[model samples]
Target: MCSGGFAKCLGVSLMPLAVVCVLCNILLFFPGGTTVDSEHITQQVWYFGGILGSGVLMIFPALVFLGLKNNDCCGCCGNESCGRRFAMLSSILFAGVGVMGAGYSVVVSAVAINHGPQCLTKNGTVMKWTYPFSEGDYLRDHSSWSVCLEPAGVVSWHLSLFSVLLVMGIIQMALCAVQVVNGLLGAICGDCCGCCGEVSM
Candidate 1:
């Protein structure tokens, strides 16, 4: 395989890149695992979507590489027309999801910069104090009990991870754009070759 060849380079490069995507998602799972009500939902969704969408997008390269390796021309599986259609549909969906992920990453980064660190809310009123100091502490101090949101940790790392995911999302979107074009071409070819009925390319 010529290193200079576009197809060869893309196929070879994607396999390892896909692995990196998978690893990044796994790491993101920890911080993005839980969600709180209110504004936290949106924040969590963005982070989660950014991580998960990239994972879905990674599958496209593998499918493309397999088709290339087999000289299948269009379809992810083989030369079958139906397979190509499926690949096209999948590409469209993946691309849509990737776009969402990218948007999510951007929102996260922007919010982190403008709003600073995030936190979870706890209703202090709901909990019954076991000791007099706990229950009467507020009374003794003449302080009022209320719900409070406390910062879990700094979000610098979270922002950094989302930045990586954003890049992946953009790259995946471009790849899927190509897949959409390939799918259209295959569909046109299939229509023209209806009489021959030979899907192999």
Candidate 2:
């Protein structure tokens, strides 16, 4: 594929991940859609932003990485191909950070999207799963039990979008690790399919 075409293809793959991250962030506000009290605490919203927004931002590097990687590889400095080498190295770093950030973001997304719907108050004690409090304040203050109930009275569990993203992050991290190793150690795989195409993972 041509460099520009390959880049466009990568962009297409990255778009869905970005959308999912965004939707999850939006859901972070509601938890169960229309039930959360937005005025309750600033920290609650902040945490939500941290997780969901952070996750989506993780894909930002995909653009830089793909563009840089599309250039020719240079084993020697000043070979002009070195620019692609620099890009490859930059991608490994950027993708590495993205992987970690994604772990946190996915975990937040999973809970916000999948787990925040089933909440209920049992007797005087509100069900435990829903943690809309930002912090674990509910665990210590039984008096705040009312806050536990969604306006609709449902308790949700802790399921995070991280389950899937975490796995993807791990896989990418491993691949990048291989790239980094190859870069630093100058290991060759006795194979050819074009330079960067020799993906270790």
Candidate 3:
């Protein structure tokens, strides 16, 4: 195993990471989780829960692979090809999400800087970031919630994770990338035997 190899990744890693993600989502709701809609059953069970869940599931295998390949546990399973590929691609996709999510936050922050956060009136309910409008009328109605979008001195947990995730995401991408290359190489190598369906047209 070379340095920084997938050998170090194990399914156990998934366990802890999943726990953290789920915990974060739980905290997010009480502490306030972003409310939106998305697709995928990702680890986080809100907004984009499905997508996040799928992403976590996909990445989980990489860790499992570590257990199988590196730790000599669960050797030579069935249908590894498709599962491995799915996991690889999904991991890359999920991890890459951090980049995109942070991009939105950055843009929101910039807009906030330009124009103060706007107050919004939905169902005649007032919602400001810091000061809760709970059941009150939105004093500052129908404008840019840009300030609310970005809290002052606010270090977003997502943003902070984004930084860390970028690195981990890169590693995940690289790992899956290599796995993809390996898969391709394996397929090509297998078919190159030149006996099954090679017809020179």
In TM-score terms, candidate 1 sits at: 0.45
Tens digit of per-residue lDDT, candidate 3, span 1-201 = 321134335333444544444444343332223332233111222343212532354345545444333322122123335343343334344334433432333333233223321222233365423432222232244332323443221223333333333334344444444544443432443212232223322
Per-prediction TM-score to the true structure, in the order listed? 0.45, 0.51, 0.35
Best by lDDT: 2
Q: Which sections of candidate 2 miss by over 4 Å?
A: 1-12, 39-45, 49-56, 69-82, 106-122, 125-201
Instruction: Give the 10-residue window scoring lowest on summed lDDT in candidate 1.
Output: 128-137
lDDT of 2 by residue, 13-113 (tens): 55566566555445545544454465532223445434344445556655654564343342332343334444444545665565566556545544443
Better of 1 and 3 by TM-score: 1
Error of 3 at 15 (Å): 6.2
Q: Name the better of 2 and 3 by TM-score.
A: 2
Error of 1 at 6 (Å): 6.8
Give the count of colliding residue pairs in each prediction.
Answer: 0, 12, 21
Per-prediction CA RMSD (Å):
11.7, 8.0, 11.7
Please list the C-alpha lDDT of all candidates, in the order they appear.
0.42, 0.43, 0.35
RMSD of 2: 8.0
Scored by Cα lDDT, where does model 2 land?
A: 0.43
Per-residue lDDT of candidate 1, residues 82-192 (tens digit)? 554454344345445444544454454344334323444344545421112222233334222221232232243344555565566556556545544544544444312
Ranking by TM-score: 2, 1, 3
